[model samples]
Structures are given as structure tokens and as C-alpha cells.
Target: MIRYAPWKVASIILGTLVAILLVIPSLLPVSTRESLARAAPWLPARAIVLGLDLQGGAHVLLEVDTPSVVRSRVEALRDDVRRALREDQVKLTGGIGLQAKGVQLRIPDPADRAKALPKLRQLAQPLGASLTGAVSDFTVNEGDDGVVQLMLTDAGIDARVRRAVDQSIEVLRRRVDALGTTEPNIQREGNDRILVEVPGLQDAQRLKDILGTTAKLEFRLVGDSGANPGDVEQLPYYKASEGSGTLPVEKRVMVQGEDLTDAQPGFDSRTSEPVVNFRFNLRGGQQFGQVTAENVGKPFAIVLDEKIVSAPRILGPITGGSGQISGNFTVQGANDLAVLLRAGALPAKLTIVEERTVGPGLGEDSINAGKRAAYVAAILVLGYMLLTYGVFGVFADIALGVHILLIFAFMVLLGATLTLPGIAGIVFTIGVAVDANVLIYERIREEAHSGRSILQSLDTGFKRAFATIIDSNVTMFVAAAILYLFGSGPVRGFAVSLGLGILTSVVTAVTMTRMMIALWYRWKRPTVLPI
Candidate 1:
């Protein structure tokens, strides 16, 4: 135990050197690191990412619009019911009746009701698989007088809201990523809300705009003079610089924005105006071609969020699956629209219920405070070990320094975000790091006083304390893992630092310190052990 092979000694030296090199870029100034990166592109230039709390950014809490989600689901169910009845040749006495939670219709013939019952029941999809069983999204109820009601269950609504939140998170993530920010935290807060944290982004309003836009695009035919009143509805038409007015449009959607595969900002060749160009998938392309081919010389409306952006007549069949939208958009407006289209529409509307912006000044103050606390902690730990253990204390202090370097190196490589709580975790671990050394040193003192030789005492002391060290560190590591798994934001940051510190501390406190002592003993051949 007192001796190490030459390869082992060489490995220790090489590892420490590599860790120092990895941590050096983080310690350097941003400008210096950038210069170094430009000069030597092969070198690693990554530094530890600072969390929102330490870097100042936007914090937005958005709640999914439950009413909108329910309304959408009901409308979709109405469409499905209509399609089912038409396809099955089961005639209804009246139009599909819209309800707050679902739809209803009347089938006068008992045979038609019997035929429609199974068809409508087929529309009820299984929500998802679970331990107990799968539940249907909606229930089909048949009442007397041939009246049938389709009601959405509460569990179904809850499940839809949950799914909307999940999809919204992904959409928001894509939108935020387009801004070129680093390490944004986008996660679900609860069943119906999402919490977004963007580090180093001070433009809260822009973030809100990007997140709030539903970007629901649709294409439908303009209502002709002879069209039925119930088949058409008046929607607001948005004309640039001309004020908004109403235009009658058909209710049937020809194509939806979900079929769009890509969107880009470009200029209109004829008018030299900014526009958004979009390409649709094969299914949408086929539908679009068929509609345009049959509707030549008729007007079609391009709608976004129920507002008409443009109403242009179908000149001919556009078989290429690509089209452009012109609405007198500015360059920035065109770009923003393209981004939204590329990110895809949110499953439901999201309202920003809470917003806060952290200023850089406050972030700077936090960073300084954390540095002071860490410096004080290092000084106290180093001074205490020196005063208590003399020359051996110096060895422990060196190991402690190496442990810190290893922690920073690991964080840099992993790209972990450092928060104020993370700094506190590092300080707390600094004190905990030397506990193993304390245990070993005290054990050595006991053995030497019991009349064992200095070499025998050192060997027995390390072996005896090693198990206790592993047991305690393992417990702490498990606790850190639990915290990381269940906690969010700052708590997670603290857990990361604590978990990493535990790993490095074990190496430094046990392996590195023992190696130093072994080298010292072999070289000096000391008569008495230093206490």
C-alpha cells in the first residue's frame, strides 16, 4: 500500500496535467479565450454555462388555454361525425349540433341510429395505455326519440391539456433555439403550464411574442354569392395600411398548416416586397393541386388565426406544392412569420400569465457574492488543515486544490450550468472533502501512539479508513442523485455540483493524498511521522 508502480505514478501526473489544461480556458477572460480559439481551432474552448440566475434573462410562465383546447377538440369531433355519417350513408335529420363539450345529432330512423352508433363509437379513440387500462376520449350516448349525444369525458379533457402542454414545450424550444441563445430551460411546470428560462436574453417582450403566437394557418375558398348562409362565415381581413374589414369565407378547410414541410422568408419577384414562401407535404400538395384545378377563376383565401391575409384568385393548378404569401410584410415581420411556420403551430393557445426579467447588474452582484463565499471557504479549509496537520496538512491542501480543478473540468466538459446554489454546493463540498483526510490522520495518530512503526501506522490507517470513506461518500452521492432526479432549476444545479464534488473528493482525499505520503516517505526516510 505504501508503494506505487511507475505507470501508476505517471498516470497520476498525466491526469492532473490534463485536468489543469481543461480548466485553464474557463479561468481565462472571454476575450482571451476567443483569441485562443481563433488561433488554435483544434483546442477545446468550452466553458461552464451560467444559469439564468447567474446570467440574467427572461422567465416566462405560460398557461395553456383550456377553453380553446376543448373548443378545438369539439370542432374536430364534429367534423369526424359529419364524415362518418356521410361515408356510412346514414342521413341525419338536421345538421350536427355544437355543444360546449361535444356535439349532438338526431337520426329519425331507428335503423340509422343503430348503424350510426357503431360508426360514432369507432370515432372514440383510446386515450393512452396505462397500468389499469385505457380510457376512451369521448363517450357516445343514445337517448330516446332518436337523439344521440357525444360528450367529452373530464379525463379526456385533462389528457388533451397535458398533451398540448407537452407539444407546446417542444414548439417553444424550437422557437427559442432559433434566437441562437445558449442553454435555455424549457420544461413543463404543471399539468397546464410551461416555464421557460432563457439565459443571456434580456428581450422579454420578444420572447413572449415568439411564444404566444399560435401561428395556425389555413386555406379555404372565398364564399361565392350563391353559397348557403350557413356554409360561410365573416372573418376579419387584415390589409396592410388599409385598416381591417370583414370578408366572407367558407368554413371548410382546404389544407392546414400542419402539412407545411418548410417555410422561408423571401422577396416577391413581381412586387419586390417581402413575403413568406412555404412548401407543403405530398398529401397537402395533392389536395392543393386538385382544389386549384377545379376552382380556376375563383378566389381563395389564405387565413392565419382566423384572419384573412390574402384573397387571390386561383390562376391555375399549382402542382409544384409550393406557394408564397404576400401581406405587405416588413423584412423582420416576414422573418418572424417564417420562423413561426418552421417551428409549427402550438397545439393550443398559450397565455403568458407571469413574466419577470432579471437584470445583468443583479446577476453580476450574485456572481461576485458567490466568488467571495468560495474564496473564504477555500482559505478557511486550507488554513485549518495546515494548522492541524503541519507538513501532512500541506499534502491534503494540495489534494483539495486538485479536487477543485477536477470539478470545474468536469463541469466544463459536461456543459453543466452553474447557479448560485451550485457555488454554495462547491463551498459545502470543500469542507466535506477533507473529512476523509481527517479520519485517516487521526487513525494514524492513534496507531503511532500505540507503538506501531511510522510506516505500519500509515499503511493501516489508510486501509482502515478507506471503507468508511467509501460508505459516507456513496451515501452523499446517492442523495445528490435523488435531488437531481426530482428537483428543478436551481436545485438541479446544486445537485450537479454536489454530485461531481463527491466523485472528485474521493479521488483526491484517498488516492492522491496516499500517493504524496508514499513519495515523501520513500525519499526522506523519516524517523518520526509528522502530526
Candidate 2:
């Protein structure tokens, strides 16, 4: 082990020099770091980011209403069936609406029953291609009362929920990234919950505001039955006018936010006020044009999250696919709306069920405590090694320091987050790193006592101890890998630090320490070992 080739020696020296170079930027100021990055694009410019527990920030637990998404799909299906039956001129009786776990519609007339059954089955969307044919999302069945039932299949519901969760995660990532918080951690906690941690965030409330808003936008025509108490479909909206009791709007949507292609915060040229300007896709633009052209004198409500934000009259056709939404909005509000529109609406609403804030002062205290612990541990370990092994102990201590430097170098290169537990990992690593050196030195002492020369003792010690070191560090590495794969948040940080420490410890302890001892041995030509 002590006999290294010329190329191996050069490589080790080069690697150590590279580690020092890469780790230097992390310790420097931001300006110097940026300058170094500009000068050398190959170097890792960014420092290790602190975690939420270490840097202090907003921690939020949001529960997504996944059931509500399923319910809304059922409701939409009911509406579509009603519209389809009516448009096909099929006579329908009894209520056509959502039932326990499916949609139910009655065709009392025997003649129309057969006709309606075919039409209802036609509305069934194929789940995917199959050997027999397309698999439908719903199973159709007829009852003795001439009622047709469309029950949603279990596979359908499962697929819907899975898709909703996936889309929600993607949208949440986009929203958090839009906020420009540094190294924000957004991940799904369970089937219906998301955990968000934004480190170094000062305005947690603002983040809450952004996340809370569902930002669902739609356009519906203003209803005619304004004051009628007997209207079932016409619900009253207070924001339509001041003290107007209520301004009814249609239940059907003319344009959904899914059709929106772009949205930006800009000033309306005519009003010279902040507004959210939006554009739609080709199909949406055509539909919007036809609606506006047909109802030139009619007013339509622009609804956002169940509230009528604005009701504007159709003055002309908008064939350009672009329009402006002017409301009682500040510049910031308009910008926020634009951002929401651009990110697309969430699959389901998210309720902030739990929230907490960790202050920077607490993080500083944690960091200070961790540093003190590390310092004390390092001092005791260094003192013990020196007292036990003399000059050889100093070589081990130097190797230990290099082992730490390499860990930080890897952390920066890997963009690892540092937490309090990560500090614990490092301190634990300090002890473990020295343990390998201790094993080798003790083996050398044994070999020297057995009438072997110093060179023979050193070679035999490192060679025989190699297998034991490999076994111990390999086991540690496997445990850390498992932890990292299965664990979350702070546990992951610990795994990362611990894993990196294992690798660096192995490298520095085996190669660098032996190299240093070999140089010392050659220079002194010692007849007896240092210990």
C-alpha cells in the first residue's frame, strides 16, 4: 500500500490541489465567487446551500382536495350528458344528474330508451387501445325503471387521482420556482399532501397568499333572471354591482383557463391602469370570437375563483386571440394573476393545513452549537491521536483535515444542502475517518514488535488493514445509500454528508496519509518507527 507508482503519485497530488481550488470559492464572498466563476467556467461556483432547519424559512404542509377533483369530474360529466341528450333531440325524463358514485338519467319513454342508450354510450371516452376495442371510463347499465346509470370504474378514479397528484406537483414546482426563493424544497408528502420548505424566506405570508389562490379563471354570460327568487341555475353574485343585491350569471362556462396560452401584467392603453392581458389558443380564440361577435351588446362575467372579478360588454369581435382583464388591481396583484395564469391552474385546491416559520436567529444558534460540538470533538480526537502515536499521529490529523476539505468540495459540487444533522454526520465522520488511520498504525506497531523493519511493518500494516477498512466503510456507505433513498428532508441531508464523508475518508486515509508517511520515512531513514 505504501508503494505508489509515479502516475499515481502525480494523480493524488493533482486531485488534492483540485479539491483545494474548488473548495476555495465556497469560503469566499459572493463577489469573489462570481469573479472566480467568470474566470473559470469549469469550477463549481455555488456554495453549499443551508437547509430550512439551518437557515430558517417557511415550512408549509398543504393538503390537496383530491376527492373534490373526482367530484368535479362527475359534475362535468353530468352536464355534458344533459347537453348531449338535449342537442340530439332525445326526450329525457326524471332528473339527469350525479348519483351516489355515478351519473343517472331516466328515459321514461320506451321508444327513446333504446335511442338514448346508444347516445349515452357514445359519450364514453376510451381509456386506451385494447385488443377487443377501446376501454371506456364508465360502465353503462340499464335499470327496470328505464333509468340509465353510468358508474365510474375503479381504474378510472385511480387514474384520475394519480394524474391529479402528478399535475399538482408539477404546478407547485412551477409556482415555487416563480417566487425566486433560493433552493426551495417542494415535495409530495403523501397521497394528498405536499410539503414545502423555502429557506431564507423573509415574507412567508406572501408565499402563503400565492399558494392559497386557486386562480381558476372562466368566462360566463350574465344571466337575465337578476332578482327572481325561483331561479335554480341563476345564482346571485355580490361583486357584480354595489348594493345590487345580486347579479345572476350562467352556470355554463364559455371559456376555461385551460385554453389560455399566455398572460402578462401590463397597462391598458385606454385606461392607463394595471391589467392582466391574456391570449388564448387557436380553438379558444375562434370560440371567443364567435361568442363576442354573436353577443355584441351582451355582458359576460369574468370569474376568478368563484368571484366575478369583472363584467364587460362585448363591444366587438376579438379575432386576434388576445384580450385584457382590467379590475380593481394593484400592480402587484396584476403581476400575481399573470404569474398564476402562466403557470396554469392547479389540478385541485390546496388547503394550508399546517404552517410554521423558523427564524434566522434560531438557525444561527443551531449553527453555533454545531460548530462548538465539532470543535470540541476535533480537539479531543487530535489530542488523543497525538498522545498515542506521536509524529505519525500528526500525519493522521492532517489526513483528517484533508478528508473534511474533500467532503465540503463534494458537497459544493453536488449542490448538497447542509442541515444540523448533516453537521452531526460530519462530526461522526471525523471520528470514523481517524478510526481507519488508528487501525493501520496499531497494525504497524504489532508488525514492528514482531522483528520487522519499519518499511516492512508499514507495508504489512496498510495491506492487512485494507480489507477491514473496506468492509467497515462499505457497510457504512450501503446504510447511507438506503437512508438517502428512503428518507426525507433532514434525514436525506444526513445521508448525503455521511456518504460523502465515507468516500473522502477512505481516499484520504488510505492514499494521502500513506503518501505523507512514505515521504517522512524516506527523508529520515528512521531505524525505528515514530510510535
The number of the candidate with the highest lDDT is: 1
TM-score of each: 0.95, 0.86
lDDT of 1 by residue, 412-431 (tens): 88988899999999998998
Off by over 4 Å in 2: 1-7, 28-44, 83-90, 109-142, 152-159, 225-246, 270-272
In model 1, state the lDDT of residue 260: 97
Candidate 2 structure quality by residue, lDDT tens digits, 386-426: 99999999999999998998998888788888999999999
Give me the displacement of residue 512 in model 2, in angstroms.
1.6
Return the clash pairs for model 2, or none.
none
Clash pairs, candidate 1, are none
Best by TM-score: 1
